[model samples]
Target chain A: MPDTGTNDMTEILQTPLHDLHVELGAKMTPFAGYDMPLQYEGIMAEHNHTRQSAGLFDVSHMGQAHYTGDEAALEKLITADLAALKPGEQKYTLLLNDEGGIRDDLMVSRPFGEDGLYIVVNAATKAADFAHMASNTAGVGELRIIEDRALIALQGPAAADVFGALLPAAAEMVFMQCGVFDLEGVELYVSRSGYTGEDGYEISIPAANAEAVARKILGDDRAKPIGLGARDSLRLEAGLCLYGHDMDENRTPVEATLMWAIAKPRRERLDFPGAARVMQMFADKPARKRIGFTMSGAPAREGAEIVKDGKTIGVVTSGGFGPTIGGPVGMAYVDLEYAVADTEFEILLRGKARPAKVTKMPFVEHRFYRG
Target chain B: MSVKFTKDHEWVKVDGDEATVGITAYAADQLGDVVFVELPDVGKSFEPGDEMAVVESVKAASEVYAPVSGEVVAVNDVLEGEPQKVNESADGDGWFVKLKLSDKSQLDGLMDEAAYKAHIS
Candidate 1:
């Protein structure tokens, strides 16, 4: 039973393919407005399966939007300096609130031509992204929200071989590049980027072909349908943030340990929204920074408080069993002193403090296909 | 002979002075894939309901409790590397610990397979 006083099930939302998850014996739970599968065969199995083989993920709930303005004029609309975005190159960036808070972090890729651009935003913040983009596009040419498309990410070491055979062109695109291709008769915008620290591809196709194409990929002996449970763990192992959890409007990229997403030109020019505050933050050094840690006891779940020497310092954003690391791993914000790698702290798990230590991000090494 | 279960979902198969401990199949299924098992040191003694071992899955961690008061005589070393065997054969080959019972009277407090099933359902 759910915590009666805490969660309201009626307010929970369901995804477009909620029934399909049920049919596949997925254990469902509320996640970011959608009733998503926590696991199917199990989180550990699915996690390990994806690491050693291939795992099929249903990520259709993510927002897909396209911007069609003359490529030469696109640089003026986005917060990032899109003018420098060479065709086929992708960059991780964030849309900022006027006050310097992160509206959402996203992947922006210029597809075939300079005239058309595609962006993938977090599922929970898609509404705000659409609203922001819609308002901004009124002055530009046209901003089209591709609501009819679905995204499926096949992630793992074997992802290349599995996806390579299906779309030869896609297999050739190096990490952070995009290619338009077809798999099993369904056309898609396949990108060589993923949250898991593995060589993988995120394929965007028409919603009509979502299930059919997913089934076809899962038909491969190396691929097994994964669920949101392993998805969280996989990304955790890869040190990727889960938006609302690790970052939000109240957090800046620098504070979130995502300074790399900000370009040098933008940082120096201070042209983006909240640039003054972000620039100051970089100059002064943010007080609290996101850091990774490993818990010694029972998994320190979300909302667990972090303490050092009996005083509360921070709170865990995402914490749970990391199959790849073979222990409980999590991300949290702490006093800069405790954020150093190997700095010991304690996680208050169910009221009992357990020993924990700060560690480097990506508990598992990333394996992007730079080749 | 009697069987008892802890709320943590471990079971103790008691036969007089000997007790065999393992996680219930239901618990194993709910846990999904078992990646690693931290076995209690052999000869370690614990009472009923004490967390004796750690079971890790991809998403969470669970405690395997002692079903009855006893000293662990042996542990399933095979699980150190092949923890998935618990998901495959949780009842037999996946048995976690063999304890030399400290009190045989504890067996009377346990439930049979049918009763344990009803309790879980």
Candidate 2:
């Protein structure tokens, strides 16, 4: 089963678009302390709809912050080389604890003509993540959590066309580029980036105007409001990691197969948090490595055990039906020996051992638009 | 033949000692897009409340329970290839199994069509 990452202790929060989701007949579920839409029509239909056109996602539960400080203060905590980040460019990076374990995965961008770096972190880790950044960056710079904004992602093939019709200049931005634009007098910080491996833009809008902008976008024939259900499947098919599942505080970037996200300069400098241990892991190779696999029969879900010859070697972290591939696809952290493509294994589901094999990810190929 | 429903959302159609079983439309609608179904083997005996089958949607897997004690006599092989049948016609062609009832008195404990509808509503 897909983990909703629901935190029950906190009072459930609602996004600005919560009413719109309810009006659209969404089945709401508690997720990361917020009541969010799980699906609209159905997961299969919405999953297929997004692969064909555009799907709007309310990612407002995610934490967004602005940092104006010495770049070194922030760079020390993450794996990215902030000094090398150019205006209008974004980098996927990881925040690490002292031991080199990933605290959370996030996006850091330099909005075009903006004074400070713009960062986005996962919802479940936001509170602690913000506190960590605030405490660490004390006096060197300021970390301002942007509570007045709401983030929305318009993803899939037709996203550009649907969103571009509103702001012509946005269509010109390539993948990983960020810019500030005006939409009917509302300022939007938009980045050509998304969790789905589709060509898309993540728009940060003022909370008060979010519903109006979302309604206007959904007015187009190519766009529909997608929920967390399809969002999980889409990202799984694209081989994107979901924080708190695929990787958490226990796994380092090296073990999660996210070494590419660590910039070359940062690697050479070895200045980022846990750099020594992470680099050492890079050299010695981690005992366990993340891998992707496809299998027939029932989908193996998170916490499912993976075995090789009756010996447990790994555990599934993310899994479900890949509507695009028409079969089961999942990710697991397995013994380094079993992480190779074509390495056969068995996944234990309900006490039955179903045959599986490690396969290269993007179980469906990524279609990011790079200009 | 008389139709009975279980609180777990399965429906049983009794004809003498044999009964046909499937999830109710309300259950199927709540599941949304059934993608896989694991039926029990024919001849397997099950007690009431036993997990007789597993129905998987794109999002989750749910166990279908035996409302009355029985031995599986025949399984719906079509669901193996087209599980969406559960969503399309959950009460008809999507029927899960044919059970040889072990206790006819168990049928009396289940709800009738009207009672089942009222229970769901």
Candidate 3:
């Protein structure tokens, strides 16, 4: 289970759309130091709604910042080749600790004609992430945290149709492309990328105008307000990793099955933080590899032990029902020998070993718009 | 027949020494979209507060505790295929098990419909 940390109600923070969420009858829960909506109508309903239509998600709790000055300064800290990241393009990258462990996974984008990079990090680790970036790049670049902005994602197959109606220019951009757009006088940084495995956009608007813009998009009949519950399910089906749950400070990118995020040029240079260790893992292959699996019976949630022939091989990191697939799906890190697809294993749930089998990821095919 | 409720959200409907058990509508609503259920075996005995079954939602798993000491007379096998019955007809066709009461006195301590409603409210 994802750690829904126990937060003192008095100190919990609220996003800009807190009132709007409550107005929509969202069940509020504390997540990442913010009092966020856990669900609206319900998880299943919201999950299906997003798959069939467009869903709006308030992700303002995520950290957004502007990295100005030297691109090399920023590249040194992450795995992505920032120099190759053209204007109006975005890349999913990871911030690695000196030991090659993933500190956080983030999106680094360069808005059209912009001088600096627009970065968004996970909410839970934003403070530490910012501090790391600031302290590391002090002499070369400036890491300006964007606290006055609110981020929201409009996702799903119908997202393009609903969003295109508002801004025709933005709708034309393909996946991973981003640009600044004017939405009825509101200056918004819109990225044609999202966590859900659908063609969508992540829009960053000034905190003050967030509600107005969100309400405008939600005004469309095809779009519904989604909460964290469905957001989690959508990403899980997409085979996307949740920052804290899937990869953490102790897990390296190779072990987490995210080596593709490391740009080839960076790999050739072995210049990013812990590049030597990461490359060595690439050559030797990590002892444990993350794999996706499908299982029957109760969902094998995080902390469930993965067993093969009565011996503990690994453990589940993320697991839940994949609404799209109509069954239980999850990810786990198991001994490399037991990570092959179709390999049968047992997931110990409540002391009972339940049958499970390794399966290919993105249990649902990704429908990214690449045009 | 007298229907009694547990604070844990289980409902027990007694017909003589035998009783039918299921979750209340309130409990079903709280556990959105029942995807799977693991039923206790028939003939198995459980004391009050013991885990009788496991109900899984799309998001998490919740344990259904035994409301009173009883021996499971029959398990709801239909739930294995159509667990959503718990969400659709939580008090009717969604019954999880029929139990032969091991201790009838345990039902007296449970809340009646009126008190259950008050407790939830």
Report the C-alpha lDDT of model 2 over A14-114, residue by residue, as the tens digit: 99899999999999998998999999999999989889999999999999999997878988999898878889999999999988889999999999555
Candidate 1 per-residue C-alpha lDDT over A1-371 given as tens digits, one digit per residue, 9 for 90 to 100: 33578555467665556677788899997777777888887777888999999888888788988888653343333356677888888888888887678888888888756657898998888898878777765665576888888788999988888878777787788999886776667779888989888999898978788777777787789998889988998999899998988998899887898878777777777777788898898889888889999975367877889999989888899998787787789999887777899999899864578899999988999989998
Tell me model 3's lDDT, rounded to 2 decimals.
0.93
User: Using lDDT as the measure, what is the rank order of every candidate, best first?
Assistant: 2, 3, 1
Question: Candidate 3: where is the Cα deviation over 4 Å?
Answer: A1-10
Tens digits of lDDT, candidate 2, B1-121? 9999999999999988999999999999998889899999999999999999999998999999999999999999999999999999999999999999999999999999999999889
Report the error of model 3 at residue A87, Å.
0.7
Q: Which residue pairs clash in candidate 1?
A: none
Candidate maximizing lDDT: 2
What's model 1's overall lDDT?
Answer: 0.82
Regions more than 4 Å wrong, model 1 = A1-25, A69-79, A139-141, A183-185, A295-298, A350-353, B4-23, B34-56, B61-112, B118-121
DockQ score, prediction 3: 0.87
TM-score of every model?
0.82, 0.97, 0.98
What DockQ values do the models have?
A: 0.36, 0.83, 0.87
Instruction: Determine the C-alpha RMSD for candidate 3 after optimal superposition of all C-alphas.
Output: 2.0
* B-chain TM-score for every candidate: 0.92, 0.98, 0.98
Considering only chain B, what TM-score does candidate 2 achieve?
Answer: 0.98
